[model samples]
Target: MDSDKDSRFIPVNDTCNMLEMTLSFPEQLEEAYQIAEKQELIKINHIPSSIATIGMGGSGICGNIVATSAIENIKMPVFSFRDYTVPEYIDDKCLVFAISYSGNTIETLTSLKALLDRSLRNIIIISSGGILEQVSQKFNLPHIKIPAGRPPRASLGYLLIPIIVSLGKLGLFNRYEDTIKEVIKEVEALRTDVNADIPVENNIAKDVAIQIKGKLPIVYGTGEAMGVVAERWAGQFQENAKVLTFNRTFPELCHNQAIGWEDASGITDKCVVISLEGEWEKGAKVEQRGALLDIVKGKGIPVLHINITGDGGLPAIIRAIYLGDFISIYLSALNNVDPCSIGGINSVKERIAPYIDKLNLLS
Candidate 1:
């Protein structure tokens, strides 16, 4: 009758087995890169003046990461839309990609419909199978299909590789292939430290889990990679550890979050602040993130510093993600909580079914 025996909590060994599949991403990247190179050879009649990716949850987070990473370098403005409608400025000159891992995601579907209505210049679809795929076929829009079965969060590689490849094909960036290769090497190396075989004494993730036990985690990051990586940590804590956590980006946090911390005395001691550090060129805003961490620590919050290691931008970000993921899983084990079950989310879905039916009928 013990819940720990439930299949949902797949044993650590099983989770490690699953990691093998997830880790195949590096190989997948090579294939994706080749496909993208071929796609680049095919000349499209027209290209959009701007780009936007529409999705929700993990799907949306990927878009945010890409947008932030490319914002400073991309010739056209890149945007991420989490809502049901495309921005007003997204006209015929816009390339709108609907990205939904489940394909049936309401927000993404709605946004896709809106973009179609506007006769957007170019449209791409990324999903497994659902109404999104059907729409893509109906309109002859370009689409990428990902294998189904794994949880959306666990399929980060499938979701991200396509985006990276697509952008490369579009001539948006020339360094993606090398960057991806470097990241893969870095991530493979990290497996030794984060792998299940590594005992708690020497495992960085296990060490982090022990520190964060029973505390409210507040993750902070800077720039595109670290910021999205921070958000990923918060999401992993919620889904994998079933814990309440929050995340905010640097520089921006200084504008508001710094002041709010003053009144949080009761929770200060119980809070664990994780700062994600990355390589920055001269004068980059991230250079000052360490100062922000010092300020938070001075306010009595426990602080943990994690430096994302790698020469390439993509690899550094991936390392940060894998570390956070391992930490979340270990934290769940330390807290004796199931890492996979989300009964609460299922119950909410059940409660909404009746209303959803009624709305469908009205529509």
Candidate 2:
């Protein structure tokens, strides 16, 4: 059966309406922009010499996007910390965005406490509601409260746009103010072209989903923008499509991972390589990407090239991410899995709850 055109399969498989959440991404960005514009300007005594964003999982990807985009745009160094401990260098002069959609992620909450204990005043909290929200209220720290009840992954726009707008407001990032409007329109147009109602013949996402079905997907992203987008692809494929997927960046992959294909007689047949070609890639990196893909293809592994659209930087990243999200959901339909549920992750969290509670890390 062609799951792409099977009207019954999609509705029956998508029990939790994740398709609705994925389709609403453009609206989410629109609303997030409104919310960001309404926020009061943050006041800091000293200019930030460095920037750090603390988060994990879905929420953490926002930081990854920012840190990567900052490479060529922002003057200040940017870091994404996914652990419980704060870097010793994050002092009062480093602007920190501590993001937790649930506000209770153990690592983010622990690090938030560490920042507070150190009397760091440059912290900005982004959360829906949880202990992190309570702490923000208790300390009167600048907090951007997003709408509650969304899965962190589904709340990407809410978790990300505020941080971008905030940085732009502070003069740390200058390109976002105008670029965001264009991104909003572009993403909305993409949604129309790829939504489930569109036939597989007309939908590129569905076509890709059908091609990669039953194969292990290895996503290769080039440059800072697509590197993060590649991570998003792998994560969405795992959590939404309920399959094992892997991601690595180019140039870096050339240094080590490319050699793994030298003896790929058995492994090559079961895998598909998806290369994200970012418009921002330099001439040298583009050559490296082409050479690496050629080597992989020589090993008999199938290759799919997705030339990222948009004028590079934030625009390209957002568009690539939007397309990947749609592809993941379409894949879920083919696999007959509910994209919204993560049974394995939930089981692990439940199993670890007792140990985490005993530690009293929050205290």
Candidate 3:
């Protein structure tokens, strides 16, 4: 079906129109920033000793991005978790952002309740509406409400921008509002090249999708900034492309994963490496990335290196994500799957609903 060049096949393959959502990402970022800017700045009397963001799956990923982007910028430690339990070390002095797009994710609710139980007042809730909004109202907790109905994965801008802008307003991060403005412009330009209307002859995203379409995709992030992006790319491939994908950070993977590649030529043939190389990465990590790609190529595996392009930490991360997102959607077209159909996840959710009801942790 020449998924990259044939426009007719796109509609047939992507019945749910995930391409439209991907196209709107640039706009989403702008709108998200405006929404966040309009909110009254979060007021915390004291500088938090640390910051933690908690959630699972799509919603949880924003926390990872926040922590990673803040690594070199913020003085306080930042942590992100996808588990039901909050880390014991996160005392009342820690600021917590509890994210749940649906506001009913059992794990998030449980963890938020845990924080409340421990008398943690430095809590901010972000959700579209649901149990989370209700809980916020019940407890008089600060809540940032986002527009509802979009899939949590598709709401990355709305999910992430509020946290960044709020923290920036409180002097925790610098140049964030400006950085976001640049990101919007970069992504808007990027979207033109990656969007569905662009053909394989000109679209890097489509070309990359064709290269890795049938192979297992393993995303490697060159550093902390790209590492979170690597995770997001893998997730997009899973949900949008309906494929099993994995992600690992550079030097760390060089130590252990490289060893597996040495003796696994047979399996290597079925895989493609998509390395998210950050321009901001240290030369040492860049060298490691090149070496790692060479090792994979020696074993006859295909390698696709995506250079992340943007002005700074957050901007670069967003640009990479925007490109990867389009690539994932194109890959979905090749796979002939509806990108929005998450039947497996929905089935699991159905099975677990009763158990969550029984627990009644929110009450």
108-202: candidate 3 lDDT, tens digit per residue? 88888888888887888889998888888877788889999888888999999888888888788778877788779888889877667777888
The C-alpha local distance difference test score for the whole of candidate 3 amounts to 0.83
Which should have the higher TM-score, number 1 or number 2? 2
Which model, 1 or 2, shows the larger lDDT?
A: 2
Deviating ranges (above 4 Å) for candidate 3: 1-4, 8-15, 359-362
Off by over 4 Å in 1: 1-43, 71-73, 281-288, 348-363
TM-score between candidate 1 and the true structure: 0.85
Query: Candidate 2: what lDDT?
Result: 0.85
Q: How far is candidate 2 from the true structure (C-alpha RMSD, Å)?
A: 2.3
- Given candidate 3, what's the lDDT at residue 56? 86
